[model samples]
Target: MIRNKYVLYFFRIIVGGVFIWAGVLKIIDPLGFAQSIANYRLFPAWMAFFLALVIPWIELICGVLLILGLFPRTSALVLSLFLFAFIVLIWISILRGLDIDCGCFGSFSRRVDYTLILVDGILFGMSTILFLSSVRKKV
Candidate 1:
């Protein structure tokens, strides 16, 4: 865990910004995002459509709350869970020999790969750390 407040703030800003950008991109092209989700082939088409409709809003809200230091704990938890799921999904995609965009940045999404996992892993760590630090503050 990082003890420096500045370091934590940096993490917060970076993670929050990335999510906000990703959310906006997806919101701009939900159909495209839906297609990206479908590319995973793990979920039904209807589910992909539904997730495309809702997930970006969640990401946008959480990202804003995180950056504004409002509901930071909740925001961090949500983002951490999202990152965890993303990492798992990417790994599954790899094992299944599915090469497709990660749907992380909407049209700008990169292909699911080990590097994506590493990036998400780092963000997950930062989000988790923020969650823990917030918990500590409340104790």
Candidate 2:
């Protein structure tokens, strides 16, 4: 149990830091973020614009809460869901042969590829574990 706690703490810090940095970068340039989302061609222009406005804030809030161990279960669950959605989007883009920046980490993103899929997959796994652990502890 102690070892599991340590591992969870490590993953929490890394994942929280990553999301916080990504949110901050996107918040710095909402227009660019919107454009990046639009590039995915997954949503309408207005929907993209709204998502650009709200998503970063959500990421920032959840990331901070996760790192601080406040509402960890909820934060981890939300972050995990977001990561899952991103993985799906990236998969679609790859399958469609749309070679484009993932727009995952703001401007510091890489092209949509299998590597990104793997990274998100790992993140999702960590988030899931965190959420489940929190729930079990509460019970």
Per-model TM against the reference: 0.98, 0.96
Show where candidate 2 strays beyond 4 Å.
1-3
Clashes of 1: 0
In candidate 1, how many Å is residue 2 off? Answer: 1.5
Supply candidate 2's per-residue lDDT for 92. 95
What is the Å distance of residue 111 in model 1 from its true position? 0.8
Q: Candidate 1 lDDT, tens digit per residue, 27-78?
A: 9999999999999999999999999999999999999999999999999999
Tens digit per residue, CA lDDT, model 2, 1-139? 3238889999899889889999999999888889889999989999999999999999999999999999999999999999999999999999999989988778798899999999999998888888888988988
lDDT of every predicted structure (CA atoms):
0.96, 0.91
* Candidate 1 Cα deviation (angstroms), residue 5: 1.0
As a whole number from 0 to 100, the lDDT of residue 109 in candidate 1 is 89
Top of the candidates by TM-score: 1
Model 2 lDDT, residue 4, Cα: 82
